[model samples]
Structures are given as structure tokens and as C-alpha cells.
Target: MTSKPLISVIVAVYNGAKTLQHCIDSVSNQTYLNKELIIIDGGSTDGTIEIIKSNQDKITYWESEPDNGIYHAWNKALGHASGDWICFLGSDDYLWKSSVFEEIIPHMIKAESQGTRMVYGQVARVTEDEEICCLDGDSWEYTWRGIIIDGIGSFAHQGMFHHRSIFELYGMFDVSFKIVGDYELLIRVFKEGGNAIFVNGLIVTGMQIGGITSNCVKLVNEMARARRKNRLRVITIPWLISYAWAICFPFLNYIIGERYVRYLVNFGKSSVTYLSYKKNVILEHKNDQ
Candidate 1:
């Protein structure tokens, strides 16, 4: 491993043979050379293991075997990361283009120099056939109205880079969450009063269809728990408005289906995620999942 890595990219897989190789390749092509990648598999019986082994040289660090879920794999990856910055890009997701981290790293370092706790950027959705859609881009703007109510949009665990110290101070991913563990982790970052900045530039491929994160019900439940964990300051209007948005998501997706919903619902989600993105890294397995 390089003694001075600018970023550590972590990809967690559980039987994701079809997409795992593409995800790994995306990391290998990163514009940033001073990077290390960690692949933690969840006891996959599929060819996913073979694909990883084929790319063993590119994988700076990796592990195979059963794990609890995405967060568990992520927790394992964290221990092996030796970079100044960290992020988890899911097995099914890949950055849409090359040099995915190029636009954002300098800005992240600048903000970190100013003593900011973290830096987060925008994300877009990539269809199975590879068409792209924006979640938070030139097309949208989101603001945080209230603490608990802000999880409405599509800021993925993939879109942001986190500071390692934030995890040291806060704690690690809570495993109790079945779908929205990442959301719960964000709230903990907020409660700790971590400093962060929203980058106008975008990063990573996110807001995809068919992923566990695409489920509105799962998102709602995770947001509900995240709010509880943070002990929201007040029952703000955003919280009340969120209930309306939550109710509409399922029916909207059913009618519009996954493809169009990315352009529709994710606009607010990506913007909201900017305000809502966290600085926390996992410290313990308080997984309430």
C-alpha cells in the first residue's frame, strides 16, 4: 500500500457476481492514483469470488466470507483502509465516467484544511443499459428543513467522502438497520455537530434502480430511526411534510416505475442529502437492523 493515499475506495459484495467485476474495474480506473481499494465479500458462493481473485493485484486489501450486511462488509473494509479520505461504492454501482474523484479531491482537501470535518458531492443514477440521470446536479437544489425529516433525497453512501476521525469520535455503522443503515449513520454525524461542505461537483454513480436503497419503505423506516437516534431538535414542518412525501413515493414509483422516478423523486433526495450527508465513520456494531 502507498504510504500516502489520497482516498480509500471500499466495495462490499454479497453474491454480486454479475456486477462485481465492473465495480472493481471502475475503482481501478480512478484518476487519482494514490488510492487503495478494499473488497470485503459476504461469503459469496458465486463467481464473484473468482472475479475478485482475478483482480487480486489491483485490490490493495480484500477479504472473503460471510458478513452481516453492507455495513458489516464496510466495517471490515474500514479497518484495512490507509487513506486520508474514505467512501464505500456498492458492488452493483460504478462511477459513470473515468477519474470519478478528480473534481472533488482538491476541494475536499481545501475544506479539510479549513478544519471542516467532511466533504460531500452530488450523485446521479445509471440505468442498467447505462443511461444517466441526475439526483443532485445542475438540475436540483435541496435544503435541510429539520433534522429527522431531511432523509428524503438520493444522496448515496457512494457520493460522499468521510473523515476517519469522525468515526473515531462518533462510532461505526449500526448493524440493526436492514436497509437504511447508512441513513442512521448520517444522523449520528449530525448530532455530533460535525462540519461539512456541499460540493457543487458530482461524484460516483448512485440513485440506481432495484438496489435495497431504492426501496421507499425501507428508506422511510431508516429515516425514522435516524431521526430517533439524533434526538431531533423539534417537530419541524419538514418532518410533517416528509410524511406526505413518504406516502407518495410508493404509489409514484408504482405508476411511474423505477426509470422515470430517478428524475422525479431523486431531485429532492439528492439535494436534501447534501444538507443531510454525515461525517460519521463506524466505531461499533450498534446495528439496530
Candidate 2:
């Protein structure tokens, strides 16, 4: 691999004029220079095309046309990709810092030397007001185990980089999926013996509170479908209960408010996960005894 292999950053948009410029500007300001920005707009009429046109000099390739959802646009971007590695960026998300790729590329080169094909980093989940919601930093063990056992998300696309060959080997994003396609593809990656190096700092951040994927019920359903298709067994009871809670949580929030709802939900989740882990440990110890 070259000391500075070209990286293709693919940004997909749909009526995202409001946040598109910030996303493009973040890519343009990157300290790393051997990169290309590919933008695929799903026929946005909300001035998103104008944003793309204005930034053409910073972009390598782009198109605006009617297509499927995020994953389909992702597939289109993949088709046009011409870099050694590629990553998807949401139009509503931006690199956490201008030096993100500059810091990440060296690791990619090292990983290539060590025969690793994927690399991921921490993502600071933030809200529309730029307030941090949470930080994601799961390593391969945790991500692989969590998805296989719990059907939960252990990574986000914006914070991860993939060597172009992985896609050629594992196939492109499953366009039939709208929300959990990344999760599904990741399952295949892990199952096929693919691994990632976990970069130790914040790579990207974005609004955590909205978007089509933010609908907890739909996300849960899509994830369950993905898990089933991949033949990974996961307990359905807790997820079903969570789905019910998701349906009622909005109404409950309307009454009790966002802060209280968030507090209660977080407390419940932490307590349940803690108890589950404890029980599993006990069961394993008993079997050992």
C-alpha cells in the first residue's frame, strides 16, 4: 500500500440542504489530501443539488437522481468509488475534527501491512444542539458478540473505514434494507473472518435524535429481520418488550418530558443489561463447577 493511499469519502443526501455544506466543508478541510468526496443525492429538490454544485471542486464525483433509500445511494456511491479505501458519511454528520483522516490513514497503512482490511473509531453521538448523547467505542470482540447475541447496534457507518476489497469480497450494502443494512453487512464481515482495528479517539459525530433510523421500533424490526436472515439467534422477548415501550415512550414523554423519559429509559436499560451480564457469569461459573 502507498504510504498515503487514496481514501474515498462517500456522502449520501436526500433533501438535506440544511446540513450538507457542513458535511462537505468538513471533508474539504481534512488535513489528509489524497482523498476524494463522492456525493450521491437521491433526487433532492431542497437545494441540496445546489450545495453539491457549489462544492464541485472539492468533490470528485456526484449524482442526483431518484433512487432507493440510504443503502441504495450507498450502493451508487460504491459503484463510483476509486480509492484504496472508502467510508460513508451522512450529509447530516461531519468529521469530529479536521485531522480525523490525517490521524486515521497511518493506522490504515499499518493495518494493511498486518493484513487487516477494516478500521473503525469512536463516534461521539450528539444531538441537534451539538450536545453529546453518548460515545461508541466497541472493539471487535464486543461488536461481534453483541450483534450475534443481542441484535443490538455496536457500530455506526460514519465512524468506520473499509478497504475497497472487503466490499468486493463481502458484497455491497444490502439495498433492500433501509435502516440496518450496515449491521447486516457487518455480520457477514465478522462471520467471514474479517476484522477491524479500533482507533482510539473520536472520528465523527452527528445528531442522535432524528432521521428515519431513529424510529426505535422500525430499527428493532429491521435488525431482527437481519439477524434472522443471518441465522443468528437472539432472545426475542426483551426486544419485543422494548418495542412496546418504544411505541408508548413518545406518549409518556409528552406527559413526563424528555429529561424524565430519558432518565427512566437509561436507568432501566443499564439495570437490565447489568443483571443479564451477572446472570450469565453465574451460569458460566456453575457450569465450570
Candidate 3:
């Protein structure tokens, strides 16, 4: 494996005009230059095409057409990718730092040489008001613990990088799964005896409070289906509770709004996380001197 393998950064979006430019600019400004940016738009009409057009130089391949859902658009982007390695980023997400790829490539090369096919990193969650919170901590370790537990730890797609061959081996994501396609793919990879590397640092910051996946009922149903298809024993307790909440959360959210819900749920944690990260940044800067 080369030190700087070509990495394909695929973004799947719909009506994401407002946040699309940030996503494009982050990839374009990456310190690791050997990458292709592919955008799959699901027939967006809200000025998304213009945003894509304005950033033509940064985008290697892009197309806008009606698709089944996010996973279908992801499959389209995968078809267009020409790089040795691939990673999917949401249209609303971006690399956490300009040097993220530079920090990640060596680990990937090492993983590849050791027969590992996928690599994942930590992600930060960014709120609508721009407050940042690290997803790393006691709740999740940067290891295959998530794979072992099957569905316990964080397995967000935005922070994962994949070697192109995994796709050939596992086939494309189950587009039938509107929300848990990434999890389904991960389960298949592990089931097939493929290995993955975990990079213990933040690579991307994805929007935390919205998207179709936020619909708890759909997510729970799709996850149960994936587990069953893999012949794993399914648990119904959490699913039942989630279904009950999902029934009422939308109405409560409509009355209280997302920002309020987020505030109530995340109250003290986000502030503490923000302060800790700021302190680390200052310490790193001072040590550089």
C-alpha cells in the first residue's frame, strides 16, 4: 500500500444547499490532496445544484436525480468513486480538521498491509448553534467493542473509512434499509471475517439533531431486521420502549422544537465538553512553542 492512497470522499445529500459548501470546502482543503469528492444529490431543487456547480473544481463527479433514499444515493456515489479507499460523509458534515486525512492515511496504509479492510475514527457532534461535543469518552471506546456487542457502541458512518475491496466482498449497502444500512454493512463485514482498524481521534463532525435516522421507530425496526437477517438473537425490550417514545416524541418535538429538546437532553454535558476541548486546544498551542 502507498503512503498516500487515493481516498474517495462521497457525500449523499438532499435539500442540503445551506450546508453543502462547508462539506465541499473541507474536503478541498484537506492536507492529503490525493482524493476525489463525489456528491450524490437526490433531485434537490433548493439551490443545491448551483452550489455543486460553483464548486465544480473541487467535485470530481456529481449527479442530481430522484433516488429511493439516503442509502440509494450512497450507492450511486459508490458507483462513481475511483479511489483505492472510500469514506462517506453527510452533506451536513465535514472533516474536523484540515489535517484529518494526513493523520489518517498512515494508519490506513498500515491496516491495509495487515489485511484490514475498514478503518473508523471518532466523531464530534455539532449542534445547530455551532456548539461542539466530542463523541469519544467512557460510553464508547475506539475499538471493535461495538462490533462485538453488535449494536451497543457508536457506529456512525461519517467517521468511518473503508478500503474499496470491502464493497466488492460485502456487496453494496442494503438500500432497502433506509436508516441502518451502514450498520447492516458493518455486521456483514464482521460476519465475513473482515478486520477493521479504529483510529482513536476525531475525524468528522456531523450534525447531531436531525435527519431521517432521528425517527426512532424506523431506526429500531430496520436495526431489528438487520439483526434477524444475520440470524442474531434479537432483543425486544428496548425496541418496545423506543416505539412508545417514537409515537409521542414527534408531537412533543413539534410543540417544544428540536433546539429545546436538544438543550434539555444535553444540558450540562455539551458545556463541559466544549470547555474541555477548548482547554486542550490552548494547551496544544502553548506546547507547540
Which runs of model 2 end up more than 4 angstroms from their true locations? 192-194, 236-245, 252-289
On a 0 to 1 TM-score scale, where does candidate 2 land against the true structure?
Answer: 0.88
lDDT of each: 0.69, 0.78, 0.74
- Report per-prediction Cα RMSD to one decimal: 8.0, 2.7, 9.0
What is the per-residue lDDT of model 1 for residues 52-151, given as tens digits with 9 covering 90 to 100? 9999998998889878998888888888888788888888887656766776677677766777666777666777776666555322223232333454
lDDT of 2 at 259: 45
Which order, best to worst by TM-score?
2, 1, 3
Compared with the true structure, what per-residue lDDT tens digits does model 3 show for residues 1-289?
7777999999998999888998899899988889999999999999999999999999999999999988899888888898888988888888878988888888889988998887777666667666654363222322333432333223567888888998998899999888888888887877545567777655554555677767866776777788788876556433444456557767868998765654443433333334444665799899999
Candidate 2: minimum summed lDDT over ten consecutive residues — where?
266-275
lDDT of 2: 0.78
lDDT of 2 by residue, 40-63 (tens): 999999999998999999999999
Instruction: Judging by lDDT, tell me the better candidate of 1 and 2.
Output: 2
TM agreement with the true structure for every prediction: 0.82, 0.88, 0.81
TM-score for model 1? Answer: 0.82
Worst 10 residues of 3 by lDDT: 136-145
